[model samples]
Target chain A: MPTVKFTQALKRFFPGLQNMQAGGKTLAAILDEMEGHFPGIRRYLLDEQGRLRKHVNIFIDGALIKDKTHLTDPFNDNSEIYILQALSGG
Target chain B: MKTTLLLGTRKGFIAYEYRHGAWQSANLSFEGQPVSIAYADPRNGTWWAALDHGHWGVKLHRSRDRGRNWQEVAAPAYPEGAEVKDGQPASTRYIWSMAHGGIQYPSRLWAGTDPGGLFVSEDEGNSFELVTSLWDHPSRKEFWMGGGRDLPGIHSIVVDPRNENHVHIGISCAGVFETTDAGKTWNVRNHGLRANFLPDPSTDVGHDPHILVAAPGNPDHLWQQNHCGIFRSVNGARQWEDVGQPGGPAWFGFAIAVADDNPLQAWVAPANSDETRTAINGALCICRTDDGGRSWQEQRHGLPQSNCFDIVYRHALTSSGHGVAFGTTTGNLFFSPDKGEHWQVVNNYLPMIHSVQFAD
Candidate 1:
């Protein structure tokens, strides 16, 4: 199981959302597991094409994810995944 | 009766209520997101807010009990494996504008989005389906991005008051389009509009209409604030006639608003047309036309008279039964309780105002 953490900015919409342990071997699998707990959450994280949005950044174990389109970042049992929105606006 | 001003800003949404000769404010809903459009439907007491999360795509939220509580709805998303057509993107960027779907269909709502698409929701704003006829049109290839982001956007939606199926949409860099048979088909309605940025300035498809508004009293009359000039279509958009160049200021602006009762009266915030798009002469004033944009008058009673560089966006200006209200890029909101004659600043400081609408 890998632990996934959401930023405070995302918690504003999902108040009950919190850091949780999920069973997944890849970043996309982890997001899918998270979406099971919080329906419609995946839409905010990924686009319609299942590609990572331009303003979203994901890091696994202090390392940035390499694949944005496929989201194939590998995760282990104790991996820590952090999801944050890039600060960009007018 | 009370008037509520819903201010959508670059940061969040603000709700201001004016009653009893005073004003009350509440920083309600979408605390840290860019709200592109906030519409309050008095017909069904439903409030809709379109939040553009830079990283998270777009989200649509609806509140039945005003802004006290909200529930997220299904925002417009292309079908899985949807093919990109005519250089249009495959995903929806943002919901730029939303309008109620006429009196005939109280439960219907129309939404315009970036990447130049139209969506409709028959059960209020809960769920939306893209209008594919307009999206797959061959003329969409002529559309291009203007001053906005990467793709062109449908920033204005006008539904005919008499018929719910008769709809009109205004796009940036694509001009105006109308459909008589609902979303089954669409046709270019940009006749007599100019596209000065292109090699052929008279092209029908590449013109940029900043804003398109229809007078509630007379649905046949349409007013447009274009990139080249301001125009009025008295014959239901069959043809447009330039009405702002001879007497109006600069003739380049983003916002255009028309009164609910008077089809011939309208207002626009004039800005310099060159590189720097700011208030003319550093003076902030709203130009008005009483004879359907033929002649103009400047109204700046309480507005900044000099050194003002604020620019109003297309969706930022709105007119309701109460009066007209508009916000600036400088984060200032102004209101005119007595039509467009006198003005008063509602709030001088907020996040950069993106859209302003009156919730009657």
Candidate 2:
């Protein structure tokens, strides 16, 4: 199971998720589990056409995983996942 | 207990003085408005500030005797409809950056604006003349206007001490630009830079470069913080190499600085990227690269961890003879005494600090 966390800024969009834990061995599984639990969380993470949004950030551990379109990075049973809203102001 | 820290807020300008050990603010707006770029010149006993009143264009103000009295200079006019009149002036175009250079030439003043341009004033801040090289650059048409545009339009323009004509400007969507003929002709010396986020990933990775610093001791060498990572150019941007590669932390900050005593010694702030935001190890930390940016080490001793909102603006990170000072977006000013080995908070709870400068 991967521990997925939502940043405080995302609380306004996804009003239901305080915290979530999903069972998965890959990055996509974690996001799928999140969308399954929260009704519209995936839409904010992904575009209408299913591309990663321009300002959303998904991190595995501390360093950024560069597969923007697909969350195919291999995950361990104890991996920590973080979905954060990026700083967008000029 | 007169606090000398000038606070340039989003709404207006305030002068903060440290009385006892706490910080307090005094609104310095002349017409009860906000100031964008402000610098107090002790040499002439005049405080110069650029005001943004939304499409009123950029109006310059001068205060004699340190913010006690003020007078507004005539705002620069556009060439009629050839230039869009931001009727309000407060929102559309803003005076982004200001620098006072020229050792022998009576304290020259330079100001930058949105829509990408530079203006120079010879007689202090009383008047200004637009520098046309960047305004008329070959690729000026393709320059992106808003969102990720805040200081990119001529954000960093530093004149080399050894040679004045050897000037440099940091452009948005483009890499470092240099002019040897005094801004007459230009060259986009972006070799070895990463342009990996555009439709053509190879060519679009170099947009929105933040800080471009030319070491005063060695004008030939320069350091920069780009949208992708940090870079150093040994031959005045003729060639650049990624200095943030050695350190695993991603380089995603708007501020960079080089040691005044040692040109090779540099500092860059690495924040979480738009694609991957991680606060665990990647939130608001300074990376010191002793051997240039070939490698880096994190500098976080007294800084915050959870809401570590330190998004530095252009010219916000500055070095003095004794220490370094940088203002954070969270309205806090931090100073590092031992060359960024440790940090300390000088003042907290300030408005969004757009820029900061030391007085002469």
Candidate 3:
């Protein structure tokens, strides 16, 4: 199991989410698992093309994810993933 | 009747209830989120809040028991690779405004989004589909961003009470558009208006209308608070007539409201133009017109007399019967229970007020 943490910005919309140890091997899998717990969260994190939204960012164990299109970043059993929205808007 | 004032602000949403001549305010919900519009559909007792998350994206929240609890709903999004008639992919930047359908179509809702797009939800506000006919219109390319960051948006949705199929939408720099057969088709209705920013100054489609409203009594009589001036259309939006410049010195403001009983009577808060979008001479006064738009008078009783620089957004001003309400950018909320003759400050400070609506 990998630990997933959502930032305060994302938590504003999904109040039930904070930090959870979800079962997943990749970042995409983790997002799917999170979506299962909280529906409609994936649409905000990813666009209609299944790509990470331009303003959304994902970091696996303090390393920024490189594959935004496929989100193929692997995770270990003790990995910590952080998801956040990048600096945007006035 | 219980008068409820829903204020959408930059930091969240606030609900102020007026009962028996007193006001009660509630703490913020969706705290720190930029709420563009907070609307209560009295037809179904459903309250919809449009949140503009700066970084994440736009979202919609619904509450069944007023603002006690809320649940997230599917926000409008353009389909992947969906392009406009000008070959540009439609995008959803933010939801600026939302309007409920006519009584005949209870479950239907219309949403105006930033980047100049319209969305229709057949299942109330649970889900929405983009109005591609308006999005893919050939004149969409002519629409440009007026004062906001994104492209001009359909910020105003006026649904005719008599006919559910007749709808009118107002875009920032794109002018006014109306459709008789619902969202199946739309036509630009910006005739006899001026766009001072353009080379021609009177282009049909490039005019920026800050707000478009139709009185409940006369749905065919439409009033607009435009970027350049004010206008009125008595013939169902086919043509507009300039009725602003002759009545006031400053014709630049976003908010406009019409009396429920009279279509000829309206209220507008005029701000100084020339890059200073503030109350003229620091005197915040609301202009009222009783004879359609032929003449106007300043109504400043109990309002800020001096040192006021707040600007009202398009949806911030609304009316319910004889009562009129408006919220300013500086978080000042004013209400006039008897039309626009006098005013009372409901709340002085909260966050920058984005919208003010009477949730009866």
Candidate 4:
């Protein structure tokens, strides 16, 4: 199981799921698991065309994942995944 | 001559007494939480502070007695779940930027915000009405949000001092926009800017122009600190060239100041963050350029270099007759008498000092 953590701002939208444990081997699988727990969370993550929303960022570790659309980054056992609302401030 | 310092803090705003040879903080509560931008209207003797806090939301606070007391002009309320006709919300995320129109129209105030929106207050900052004409423009539909959390939030709103009709705005990751027709249309004006990390032309070019400053005397002269490097525009961003690296530690700070007495004079303080690296042991020094950003010199006569734990936020740098002043995240304030050299910590132990402006 990998752990997904949400930032303080996103907590308003997804309540009680501050940090969730997801069963997945890859980034897409983890999101699929997230959708199962909190529906429409994935919609805010993606846009009308199904592309990742411009403001959502998914990081496997500290490095930014390049595959924003499909997120093919691999996940290890006990891997730490973070879903941030992307700080859009200057 | 006398100097008045307006300090915009996260909690609220404070006025400083610079008459007896030192700066003293005069606390007031025009803001509910943290404040980001404070503009002093010298024409009508009004001080304006822009607020950005959670739950309390965004609004404006005005001071007529030079910060002795304050009043809030309630921000327009958007319906609970009303989406903007263009598919966004009316208020967006928060009020991120505010600017006085120009010396000619001192009563005019312009504001920009997150997600992506623009508004103007015609009646002396009493209230603001969204400029739906610009938001509802056909091109706005294609206006892509900068594609990440560090994406498009309106951060820079610059009004041409020479021409009131010409306006320039910088969005978080969306680069720079200009309107020649007052508010009729806007064009993405990014020519010599670059985003070295992102290999795409669209994304890399406009990823966060943190500060875009136009020369107070010459509207055509401008300077900026974006995601990549420090840039200068001689013809109002029509042409630009790299000026300097945000020198000193690996830091990215927002807040740029230019001297009103000298058009070619400018200063920038580098911080530790997303942009680039400063020296490992570098103190937060104000980098100055007297030749219109063509060359640079570092000024650190009096500043913290050992336990240098301060980050200057946007809209913090301000200059006037007394000198150039800026506040830090560590609650320490610094002022320079001869531009950037020979600084002093005039005030210490205040709340997070977000902005500092010298006026009246």
Candidate 5:
């Protein structure tokens, strides 16, 4: 099982978002699991093409994900996943 | 003057209500999001907000109870395998404009987006499908290039009041397009327009009309604040004639407002020029034409006299009844109760306003 966490900013739209443990081997699988828990949360993270949004970032075990387009960045069952927004510009 | 004014801004969506003889902040929604468009459908009084999220993609929300409650709906999307150019995939980038279908079709909506796609919703915006006739037009791939942004965007959608089937749209670097058969077919409506930025200034498809507006009293009469100058067409945009002051501040501007009651009357906010998009001579002013553009009156009273740097976007200027209002890129809003004769500051501080509409 992998533990997943979210940025506090996402709580504005998804009120029930919380840190939880999930069973998944890949980043996309974990996102699918998150979507099962949060119906509309997938669109907020990925675009219609299933690519990571330009201003959103994902981390696996404190390292940035390798692939943004395919979300193929590998993760282990016990790895920690973090989703955060890139707030660089005003 | 209308009772309510809706504003879509860089920071949020705000509404001001005129009550007890003064305009006051009535409500604020999407307080931290970039509301690209705040539209109030005249047919049903439903307010729609087009949010442009920096982290997330564009989203649409509607409020039937006037901001008291909201319902999030799916924004328009490009079908699978849709491509903007040969190798680039197409997706809804930014929603630049939105318009209601009309009274005839109560459950209709139109949306214009960046990367040059027009979306129509026949079910009151529950879902939207791309108008592929215009998207797959022959000239779109070759002549449609970006104006200021990286990709070409459609910023204006004019739904004719008399007949809902007839509509007009303005595209940056792509010229005006008209549809008479309800999006089944589209024709280029860029005759008598100039595109100085192009190598050939008289090209048929590359002209950029910054803002296109149709008079409410007479749909045949149209006005556009072009990148080169001000233009007007009395024959329903079949041909455009340059009507801007040759040596005046009205020569270059982005926003134009036509009075709803009088087809011959209109207002435009004057900017410095294309090179420097600021207030003319550091003084904020609006120009009004009452004699069908034969002459223009510069309305400068009750505005900043000097030391100003404000540029009005196309969607930030509006006119209805005897009222006219404009919002600036520098967060300044001005309103006139008597057809631009005199102005008053509605709010000195606000976010960069993207759209302004006078709604009841």
Candidate 6:
């Protein structure tokens, strides 16, 4: 299992959001797991095209995920996943 | 008379109520979010805020109790296999315009979006599905492209009051489209519209209609502040006639509001040409035409006439009853109680105003 974390700003949308353990071997699977924890959260992270939203960034064990469009970046069982919204715009 | 001015701005969705003979802020929601459009469904008193989240993408929320509380609804999404162009997946980038179906259908709602897609909801906006007929129109791929936004957007949706099945939508770089059988089939209505930027200024498509508004009294009457100029159509957009003043301030404005009683009467907040979007000659003025675009009277009383750079967006100007109001890029909200004769400041400071609509 991997520990998943999210930006605090996400709590405004998904009030039940919190640090949780998700079982997955890839970033995409982990996001899917997080979506299970907070229904309708996947859209906040990914667009309708299933690509990582332009302003969303996902980190696997403190390193930026390499695959955004495909979401194929793999992770370890003990990896700490951090889903963060990029700070941009006025 | 419409007494509430609903504003969707860069900062949030705000409501300014007209009470005690003066306009004052009444409610505020989505405090720091960019609300692209704030809509009050005339069929029912539901307040909808189309939020353009920089990070989370477009989201929709409706308040049944007039902004006291809100519930997020499913935003329109581009269906699978949909594409802006070959190999380019389509998605709803922005909810630019929204309209209630008509007096006939209480549950029906329509949304026009960026990437040139129209969506409809029938179950009181609980969910929405894309209207594919207009999306599959032949000219869409060949003619539609970015105008004011990075992608072509459907900025206006006008539902015929007589027939909820009939709708006219305005798209930047794509001209006007009318669907008489609801969303079943669409016909291009750009016969006399001129797209100067295109190689053929008189083309049947590839025109930019900044905003399209239909006269409530005459569903056949339509007014558009096009990218090239202002135009009016008397026969349900069958043939548009350019009514823009060649060398006057009424030529290059973004917003136009036609009077409810008289389709001939209208108002426009003029800006400089496409090259310069600021107030004309650094002077903010409102132009009104009472005789069916034959002549326009410029109104500047109680308005800043010097060193002002305010520009009114397409959806920021609205006309209802005897009230006319508009919000500017510089956060100035002006209201005229008796048409365009006089202007008064409702707010001199607010966020970049995106949309304004009056409610009863």
Question: lDDT: which candidate is best?
Answer: 6
Ranking by DockQ: 6, 1, 5, 3, 4, 2
Give the local distance difference test score of model 3. Answer: 0.84
Candidate 3 collision pairs: none
TM-score of each: 0.95, 0.69, 0.91, 0.72, 0.98, 0.99
True contacts kept of each: 0.81, 0.00, 0.44, 0.00, 0.56, 0.72
Docking class of 1: medium
Top-down lDDT ranking: 6, 5, 1, 3, 4, 2
Which of the two candidates, 2 or 3, achieves a greater DockQ against the reference? 3
Q: What is the alpha-carbon lDDT for the whole of candidate 2?
A: 0.65
Write model 1 residue lDDT over B189-208, tens digit each, in one string.
Answer: 98999888889888868888
TM-score on 0 to 1 scale for chain A of candidate 1: 0.94
Residues B1-360, candidate 6: write the lDDT tens digits.
Answer: 699999999999999998899998999999999999999998779999999999999999999999999999889999878999998998789999999988788889999999889999999999999998888889889878999998889998999888889999999979999999989999999999999998999988889999999988898999999999999999999999999987988999899999999989999889998998999888889999998788999989889988899999999999888889999998999999888789999999999999999996
* Ten contiguous residues with the weakest lDDT in model 1 chain B: B80-89
Best by TM-score: 6
Clashes of each: 0, 19, 0, 14, 0, 0
Where model 1 places Cα greater than 4 Å from the true spot, the runs are: B83-89, B142-147, B247-250
DockQ of 6: 0.82
Q: Scored by CA lDDT, what does every candidate get? A: 0.84, 0.65, 0.84, 0.68, 0.91, 0.91
TM-score: model 3, chain A = 0.93
Q: What is the C-alpha RMSD of each candidate to the true structure, in Å?
A: 2.0, 17.2, 2.7, 11.0, 1.1, 0.9
Candidate 6 lDDT for residue A23: 77
Model 1 residue B220 CA deviation (Å) reads 0.8
Indicate the docking level reached by candidate 5: medium
Error of 1 at B84 (Å): 5.1
Across B58-89, the per-residue lDDT of candidate 5 in tens digits comes to: 99999999998889999988887788899888
TM-score of chain A in every predicted structure? 0.94, 0.87, 0.93, 0.84, 0.94, 0.93
